[model samples]
Target chain A: MLNVGKIEEGFVLDHIKAGKSLSIYHHLQLDKLDCTVAIIKNARSSKMERKDIIKVECDVNMLNLDILGFIDHTITVNVIKDGKIVEKKQLSLPKEIKNVIRCKNPRCITSIEQGLPHIFVLTDPQKEVYRCKYCEEKCRQRW
Target chain B: MRHLMSPLDFTTRELEQLFDLANDMEQHRERYAHICEGKKLATCFYEPSTRTRLSFEAAMLNLGGQVLGFSDASSSSAAKGESVSDTIRVISCYADICAMRHPKEGAPMVAAGRSSIPVINAGDGGHQHPTQTLTDLLTIRSLKGRLSDLTIGLCGDLKFGRTVHSLIHALVRYENIRFLFISPEELRMPSYMTEMLREKGIAYEEVIRLEDCIDSLDLLYMTRVQRERFFNEEDYVRLKDFYLLDKEKLSLAKDDMLILHPLPRVNEISVEVDDDPRAVYFRQAQYGVYIRMALICTLLGLTGEEGGNIC
Candidate 1:
């Protein structure tokens, strides 16, 4: 049994799709924060069969949560307060995002200018598809 | 007030309205002579172009508007590494409307984001040419007298032809649009595009030979397989002559079938076919100017809701 301390006043990212915790870990820049982070990989789950979980010892902002949602909306964010689950959030795709991921299309103007911030709008929420605002190229999420 | 960056920018209803406006401009040319008087249009070509630039300038000038701006990237501040955003912002201060062509795809899109005025995408690499799509649509509507229930054959470089891609995206909105994609195995339409067609439930067929399908087509849209698109010189040399349309091929096509091209044609279309009554590429080029005139007037808010009463 691996023993990890519970988050007393922070977020618990639960039910991340298996094999995506490392990317979520780096994408959220969890290492830069002066806080204890426990990333439990391949945790057995009834819903997902296999999942990843991250319990942070510090309260993270909504931007970080949105980033997590963008990565994998199947994630369940549990806000812990006073050593208890105070609020549980079912992540949904964001309506708009800025500078999170670069447009990978080489011909896209964003690729050449290098100075402009990449912006994507959620065109089809059913498919979890985000389209680049300028080029209109569909942005595929890389997990 | 919206910029024309992609074919998807305008809805089907909007396109029909635009086509009607173009019709009015064609019938009553002198009535719309000075509709855009004192208005300025900027032709910002970040790539070398002959027809698209001239068509836009001619459109603006025919509407009694002045034209300005560079024809090539080397002449513009883009040579000094000026961003598309900055260039558009600066041009917006001078021109009432701007038409830009860039070798980089979506460059006009970036310009549209920063410009205060309407931005028209003349051509954006191999990504999109919305105005050209509009011209094609208008041509089809006028010539065929309708926009639905017809088979359109897209021949030659389906891979890199932005016009073909945009036209497909547009026509799929109509009823019974059967697409016949004719190209060599290597130059076939992109799988992603075919996937989109499948997802939309649009019927399409792909063939290596034009002879197999050309006779059944209501329209044959021929495209130049550019040597510039190929990384390997050998592949370019091999594929360049793979889909050439000559008098022999046209004999198999329908008598009333429209043969169109987004011109400045290479050897893909033989000059001998120009005299053929079925060849409507020149007429298609003429319609390009009128459609653009309608676009400029509408974007500048010179026309009414019905797109009438320019004079």
Candidate 2:
């Protein structure tokens, strides 16, 4: 039942983890933008219990998908036009996501100075573990 | 396709394809720079592994591609208890491919299952390190000229050394390969691998002394014996140096034999051994990249001649 004011055309990101709105904000470089955007943190969600929301007033390509990573699968993206959703899509991880996440293994040759651009090809989507291109270490999300 | 969830997933032919591609990439370096151009590689590391993380970044850059991702889980959404699946589902939109590292076993497999792109398993707990196996294959192919019919000795903490297990698993596919396992009795190769060796019907020998057959080995793989693996500190001190290979030990080794180690050495190998011609651990590190380059290329759907993948 949560709603935001209509925009000419844009996207609405829903079901994000609570209080992680800032990371997504930075990832999209929203601060540098001149367009109007709204970040709703600590919102009540029937699906997530507690979640964050993002409303982008400007047209953007797949930026909501990037934010979904910092949040969970509870994310829903609504494509709006004339103040109504024309499309709604749920995101999924690509088998080979580029430069969107970092490998966690420090001993990985990729982590070394002068190392190549670290490439992680995800092997398991359910577990979220990736392999290092150089060291061959299976990397995971490290907080 | 891109995700490497398990070592078992790589068919022999797939591994060969990776090797062949790596060889080609090494030979014709500049031509393939744009193979993955405009593509992005996202590395989502949930732990503190500097080496593995950077290697993925470097591989992407070498291919004339761009890179992005978070090094720390805290810096990313994972710090807030976000599920790995949800995170990747979202990252999939931004990146063409991804690599992830986690502490939990079988985590990468989960990520790969949900992803639309290919997944590459970097490492998963003490379970498997397939890419390291690729590095080993490249190293063996380079130094030994082939992988078959060699006396391969695995020394040090065999029980917990993921590399040793993966390498052993990989080498079993070759003909007439003999395994010489040298380790403290407490740290002998684990039962699972031992059973696997038995099931595969590969010949092997167990020993505590490094000198017994140093001259007979075609390859010597040394691993660290972490103090955490031992109960008494004195036992560690006694057994730790029991296997150290100095110049004296190398003197008995065959001139053609190569000494390899999964490194970050803690005095088990004498610094003087660095000058020895047989030392190839540093080369081992370099092979890590070339193998990765091949893996990235193949996983990203760039085809090479005679190419096929494991299930």
Candidate 3:
């Protein structure tokens, strides 16, 4: 068993698809943090066969969970306090997002403005399609 | 009522009412002449489009309203890095209603979000051109005396024609609207559009040659092969000559088949076809004015029936 010590206070990102933990770690900029962080890759799971996990010993204040949700909807965040799991946060796709995803269409005004905050609205929730609010360009998950 | 960003913004019933109003405006032009006597229209054209801008200006003028604003962005505060929001906010203070045309797909949408007055999208980048769609709808309604259960052929550049796409979007809601897309392989209609048609259970067929099925069409909608939409000049040259509608092409079409074009056409439509009774692009352009008048009136809260109270 590849068991890592539990965090006294922080968050554990679970159910990350295999090989995606590194991207999430970089996205959250966990490597630059002063706190202890561990990534368990290809961990066995009954539900997903194999998954990756991320654990941190300090709470990330600047972290945006919506980006994580937008990247992977199945990811779950578990908060730990006093060496015990306090709350389990589930992620769902956001209806509207600002400054997270960028519109890729070259002709879009957003592409030329550079200073304008990229905004997207979920037009089709069933299809997980988000269209740029300014350009009507479909935004795809980078990962 | 606040914005005309998309054709879907107006309901079918509202569209019928608008058409009725436009019909009345056409029949008795002088009756609604002073409807917008004191009002002002700001044409905030970030891009230069002669036909659309003129149509809007003419519509407001025909209603006896004043028109203002720049035809090009470089000539306005937009050249100094002012945001669309700021521009529209400023215009809203000066005008009763505004018509904006920009090169960006949703630039008008952003303006519509901030503007206090009604914002009509004149033509937003290859996106939705609601007014043009309205013009097309009015044309079809007037010419055919019907809006449903017809075979409409959309010829030439189906891929990048905003007019064709907008017309299809409006027509799909009608009872029986079957689309016949006639284009070469490289410029065929996008799959996203076809998928929408399939999802709606609408009948449609794609043909490489227009003459193959021209005889069965009730209306033939032609589009210019935009040089701007092409990546290379060579490709543009190759496809520019792809669909030439000369006398020979018209012979295949039915005698009563109406030919329409969102104009400023280059060479896709032969000049000889212009004199033919079937060519109604000029009438189509004239209808653009009436539709815009109806739209401007409706958006400004005038029901078009309160002729005496307009003053």
TM-scores, all candidates, are 0.94, 0.65, 0.92
Candidate 1 total steric clashes: 0
Q: Model 1: how far is B188 from its true place, Å? A: 1.1
DockQ of 2: 0.02
Q: What is the lDDT of residue B255 in candidate 1?
A: 96
- Candidate 1 lDDT tens digits, A1-143: 77888767989989988878888888888888888889999999999999989888887573376777788887888888999999898777888878888888887888878578888888878878898876778887545
Computed on C-alpha atoms, the DockQ of candidate 1 is 0.67
Instruction: TM-score chain B for all models.
Output: 0.97, 0.92, 0.98
Best model per TM-score: 1
Give Cα-based local distance difference scores for all models.
Answer: 0.88, 0.75, 0.89
* lDDT (Cα, tens digit) per residue for candidate 1, span B247-279: 998999999999999987889888999999999
TM-score of 3: 0.92
Better of 2 and 3 by TM-score: 3
- lDDT of candidate 3 over B1-311, digit per residue (tens): 47999898889999999999999999999988998989999999998998999999999999999999899989999899888888888999999999999988888888888889999999888888899999999999988999998899999999988889889999998998888999999989999899999999999999999889899999999999998888899988988879988899899888888999999888889999999999999999999999999999889987568643565
TM-score, predicted candidate 2 vs. hidden true structure = 0.65
Which scores greater on lDDT, model 2 or model 3? 3
Best by lDDT: 3
Model 1: lDDT of residue B152: 96
Q: Candidate 1's error at B47, in angstroms? A: 0.6
lDDT per residue for candidate 2 within B1-311, as digits (tens), equals 55676555678787777777787777877867777787888888877667777777877888877888888768988777677677778888999888887765556666776787676767655666677778888988877888798999999988878889888988898899999999989788988678778878998899989999898899999998877556689877776765788999989999999989877778779999987889999888778878877777778776444443211
Model 1 off-target regions past 4 Å? A42-50, A60-63, A123-127, A136-141, B304-309
